[model samples]
Target: MIGLANGCSATWHANRIFFLTVAAYALAVVFAASHWDIPLNLRIYSRPFLLFGFGVTVILFVVIATRVMLERPARLFPTLGRRLRGYDVVNRLIVGVPVALTLPVFFSLFTSMKNGLSRIVPFYADTTIVALDRAIHGGQDAWRVLHPVLGAGPLTFALNFLYNVWFAVMFVVLFCVTFSTGDERLRSRYLVAFVLTCVLLGNAAATVFASVGPAFVMPFYGNDTFFPLMNYLQATNAVYPVWAVDTQRMLLAYAALDGPRPGSGISAFPSIHVAVAMLNAIYLWRFSSLLRWLSVAFLIAIELGSVHLAWHYAVDGYASMLATPVIWIFAGWLSGLRRWPVAATAVS
Candidate 1:
């Protein structure tokens, strides 16, 4: 019992330390970039909004840690013996390691590791959007022909806007499910496998497309809401008290990255937001009918939002839809180890 508690406590300490470090580095890079006016190897690191977001993130982290820390495993499951020892280690690791190690590495990879993008896109254009941009913005009549049915009006337009909410909803659900169900081995396994998939999908989409998104590529498409907020974030510096009321802050938190301009001229393809919501759907499909319908709704909104808002070229959505199933299958394959456990521990 004493050894398990010490091990779990150590893991928790390591994770909290890493999280604080990542938050600090991200803010330091953003602030240094903004004030010094020097090119920080990564483009996103220099913006004022990024700096502000980092500060806010630090505060939120502390609050969440304080709230959740009290319920730490040793307190929750008092009884322990050799039989339950293995699970105690695995459970603590799952809860602590993903928070401490995985998330920081995942975010760090994108902010610095530009080479990952280079490695994958060697066969394709440096960024996949060049040909795509021309095809849609070109004098092609096929886009116009296809536009009418996909365009947002009173009927599907509200549905179109809802995709924005779904992605956030999905992420919050995963965070809550994994963090709250700490004692159940089966539940924890599902949470780990699914959150890992969501995080991977997010990074992969960012690497594959390297897009700021249509909200930035060409903001006039009516969904200028996402673009303007991002534009505010990329060009600004310093967090203001009133800035908390600013819509752009929420937009940036939800969005993986922002573009150079407030609107028009950023990565605008493969709608990763859509991809994430879809991934959530795949995980929840078997468990909840509510999620299954939400997933279908999410995809439809994604298809319409991308085209109607002119945020993504039609091909981007099509590509995302095609790749989603493949990514889901791959993530599932990693989690196939559950039938036979490497080790299992029960709590009394």
Candidate 2:
């Protein structure tokens, strides 16, 4: 451990808080699995490892292509060789492997935690949140309010497509941050903030609030409060692929299983999807004006998607957007990160 630590970057050391956080969360996951007799499968690691490998390949290809284009075409092989230097490769792997490995474990455990939530605390918050959603949206379900503009089948389908885009966008950010060679302090803070957002808003807060969103309430609790919205989504899906409909059905199936499954967790309140989008926007805001505005636009789409797609109430997005900045600030403080002025260009 000391030998490995000796060659680590300051940025790597700065991620100590994030490392410790995941370690602690892993412990909790283990305890929960043992107590519940849930199988902790090693195979769960394979998916993330494969994804990490693919991302690394893509990054390397992009770098090599850009360098060869800018410098000399003949240096392509040499560039690849130089880029694959054993020490640099090993060093980055040392720094990045754990970061890459965290997702599968984090998500698998998150699924377990969310699945176990209702067992520990019955979901009694949905009906109440339904009423609260109406009151806050001027006595109409938030989806109804959105129907005037977004009610069209093609638009609804487009929003659903963008909502699914969140996963890819999120992975890209994570991959960049893990492999980033610039601004270690900033990277550390963002990493810490990202983990905190998942644990706080996604896990702890979700379990406390414990409400299935509009899509699942009817299936889970026999409440048709959101049936009309679900019907509309289903109708749109029939014409164009509103993938959320199928994903929601899959979640319900996973929720029924006795053991934890990959990508099985589901919660409505304090939308993690929106919170993550907000975090990405805030972090990238300092990089460049283009990234700032693009991320901000994505954030808005995610909020609107959450409602129109029937995955969350308006208040879920509202609460998530509100709490994310607080978590980001707290994470910054925890990491002792200082504010840096915006940069005109992003680091390569």
Predicted structure with the largest TM-score when compared to the true one: 2
Task: Give a tens-digit lDDT track for model 2, residues 89-129.
Answer: 65556656677766667766776776677765678788888
Q: How accurate locally, in lDDT, is each candidate? A: 0.46, 0.80
Q: Cα lDDT for residue 93, model 1? A: 42
User: What's model 2's lDDT at 69?
Assistant: 70
Off by over 4 Å in 1: 1-3, 6-105, 108-146, 149-160, 180-266, 337-348
TM-scores, one per candidate: 0.49, 0.88
Clashes of 2: 0
Worst 10 residues of 1 by lDDT: 258-267
In candidate 1, position 125 carries an lDDT of 28
Candidate 2: what lDDT?
Answer: 0.80
